[model samples]
Target: MKARLPFIFIIITMMLNSIGIGLILPVMPSLITELTGGSISSAALWGGVLATTYAVMQFFMGPTLGNLSDRYGRRPILLISLVAMGLDYILLSLAGTIWWLFAGRVIAGITGATFSTASAYIADISAPEKRAANFGLIGAAFGVGFIIGPAIGGFLGEIGPRVPFMAAAVVALGNATLGYFVLPETLPQSKRRTFDWTRANPLGALMSIRKIPNLTGLVVVFLIFTISHQVYPSVWSYYTIERFDFTPKMIGASLGAFGFFMAIIQGGVIRMIIPKLGEMRTAMWGMGLNFVVFILVAFLGEVWMLFALMPLMTLGAIAGPALQGIMSKLVDDDAQGELQGIFASVTGIALILSPITMTSIFKYFTDSDAPYYLPGAPFLASSLLEISAMALLFVIAKRIWGTAATPAQ
Candidate 1:
């Protein structure tokens, strides 16, 4: 337990942050509708406003935060971000108007780079041999958080939405205190690089990517894979609502199910499989499985079928550590901060693009009063993108890393 302290802290912090986010999402439409004189579209647009604010802030700050962590070390960045996250939750809890909620979201987004610092912390403490396992733990944190967060949110939401928000704020502040006191700094002073504001910009992260050999193709592959993966978040709620008439609780659970599968696979299975199948093959297998599972999801509209399909989503979880391991291998020790920043920024860019493109396609096909709303279209399109991404990933593995590419042993 002592040796695992840092990992535990990072995981707990992530869990708190996620729970804060989950608490607000399910009940917000009603809160806003009542506040705004019963306009459904206003509620929807307000929701979008909060998300857009978060995405935009994350888009700009991800690389800068990563680079800052590289220079200043992970502990300070993590602590500061946690404090900000606590405030974000508190603001949301007190928010009386839609704009207040939007303000809270924007603050949360600016502070949300906690994940990047956490990633740097993992990179700092992990041995080459243990990096994948450690990173898998990070993914597990996400899964467990999402799983419990919404369940708690839904239960508390029954009492009142503000209750959940206040609870989340309290939890976030508690976690922040714990992290400040208990979490050790992973990056030692000698290895800490100087922060360069000009170079820490997102463009700086991208430009630095060009300096590395064969990284451009790998980054492109990662972006493609991210785009393919966005279907789960971008449209899952809408689909579930339209298809099964799921309530807020059910929708939360559905989202939680995806995270649940991710936690199981990356948390348990990835560590075991990586040593045997090796990272590259494991990644390829995961991608292939995601393609199949998503397509299956499109066709299988039944509620039970979704429950069954949950395990299949785990395939994508393996790809995360596998690809991160590859990226770690691609860069030298000194460049870890910049490289991780690049990785996060590229992911941010993917998050920006994927939702817009996939949602547009979904709207294009399903604008009708049909019984089913053709809810599976986005998943099918996602599958096609996944297939293309998998092919590119395999090609990269073959050429640069080669088949059977194990993390440095």
Candidate 2:
């Protein structure tokens, strides 16, 4: 039990971090709408811009933060990010204009890159054999946080749109305080490397992934998969509101359900399935499941259908931990932070592009004078993207690892 304390603390930290972000999900579109004088179309556009700004900052800074953690320590970087995130939430809570909200998201993005550092921290502590299960802890934390966050945010949103932001700020600050006292440094000084700016750029970081043996193709597959997954975060709130007229509370409830399902699958089902199917097969199956689910989401006529389908969607959670487990074994201990940072940078790039694409499709199709109305267009696009990712994964697996490779234990 004593040996597990640090891992427990790390899980708590992840949960708090996700909760702070998730708390705003149910309220964010409404907040933007209220700020923009109640225009849903305008809110969708600005929401995309806000999300784009956040992703833009993360794209540039994620690798840098990862490198910094490699040089200094994960504890400091993680603490600093938590504190900064708290402050960013405060800024958002007090925002009087669209620019202020954008400013807040920019700050949040810069700090949020700590997620890569957090991943590196997990890599530091876990053996290669245990990495996938440990990595699923992060996903579990996300699931738990999302479960609670949107519910709380929806309830608090009834008081005021900005209330959830203030609550999130408090939660972030509280987590930072707890971490400062308890979170141990995972990367020791002996294993630390000096930070280099040249290698930390997004392009440079991506290039670094190519240098790793038997990893580049898989990294490409993950990037495509990440972009495809971004459709949910990019348009879920707007789509539900536009198509089903879901209230903030209803949106929160839906998100909570999604999170609950994800947590259960990532925390429980993954551990069971990965040991049997192996990481490569697990990833393929998960992506294939997601492809089918996204197509179903595009055609669903009733909101209850979403609830019924969400549990099935959670099966897709296996792909990430499975892929990460495979990559973690390919890199040396010292470069773990670098690899995680590169992954974060790839996700940042996807986030940057996805919000623009998903939100634009949503806005255009839902327009009053549009040729045809189809709010589900974004989900349809996501399905197509997932199919592409699945195909890429199949080719990479065949060409790189071959058919008889043993499962990642």
Candidate 3:
């Protein structure tokens, strides 16, 4: 039990990180609408811009922070990020204009790159055989947070749009204080390396790929998969409002449901499934699930359909941890931070493209003058992207790892 304390702290920290995001999501549309004095459609465009700004910073800074953790150890970087994240929420809570919000997102983006360091912390602690299962635990933590955050945020949003932001700030700062006392140094001095700016750029991911030749195909799969996944956070709020006329409270409830089911699938179900199916087949099956859900979401007619779809919507979460475990094996132990950083960069790239593309599609399809009004257009696009990811993943997995390699054994 004593040995499990650090893992507890780490999982709690991850949950807090996600709670910070989820706590604000239900209110973001209204907040953006408030600040910009625009229609929901226009506010969505700005929302995309805000998300893109955040992603842009993460793209540039992810590798840098990952390397910094590699050199200086994970404790300082993780603590610093948590504190900074708290401050970003504080700044956002007080924002009076769109630019202030943008400034806050910039700060949030820079600090958010620490996600790589956190993933490395998990890598540092886990046995190779259990890594994928543990990554699912991380996903479960994220899901659990989402379950609480939106419910709280939706409730608080009735008080004021900014109320959730202030609440999120408190959660973040308090978590950082707790972490300062309990979080141990996972990366030892012997494993530390000098930080090189050259290796911390686009070259970093390329350099990693150069070292692990099989990673190139996986990276391609990762990119497309991430972009497809972004459709949710990018436009879900707006889509629901336009199509179903959902209130902030309803939106929160639905999102909470999504997270609840995701927590179950990732936290408990994956442990049973992955041991039976290797990472390769687990990922393929998960993606296949996601593809079906995307298509269902694209054609959904009523709010109940969404709630009905929640189980399948989340069952696909196995793909993320499966992919993470697969890639974790491709790198040396010392380079774990770098590997997660590379994927962060890949996620950043997806974030930068997905929001703008998705929101624009949302705007265009739902506008008064649209040739054909269809609020579900973005989900259609996502389904196409997901199917593409599935096809490529199968081809690449067969070519590289064969049918029976990397059994999570």
- For residues 1-409, write the lDDT of model 1, one tens digit per residue: 8888877888788777787777766666556665666343334445545565687788878767988988988888888888878777778778887778778878888898677778778877789899878886777667677888877776777677677778887887788888877898888899888888886576567878889998898888788788788777666655665567666677667667767777777667888977787767777887888888888888776899888778877667687677777777889999997887787778888777776566555554555543445667878988898789788877776687565454442
TM-score of each: 0.77, 0.83, 0.82
Candidate 3 lDDT over 300-339, as tens digits, reads 9988888888898778778877888788877789988778
Model 1, residue 30: C-alpha shift (Å): 4.8
After superposition, the stretches of candidate 2 with alpha carbons farther than 4 Å from their true spots are 1-9, 69-78, 116-139, 179-195, 212-217, 274-281, 321-342, 394-409
Q: Give the TM-score of candidate 2.
A: 0.83
Best candidate according to lDDT: 3
> What lDDT score is found at residue 237 in candidate 1?
57
> lDDT scores for all predictions?
0.74, 0.83, 0.84
lDDT of 2 by residue, 363-395 (tens): 888788767888888888888887887787777
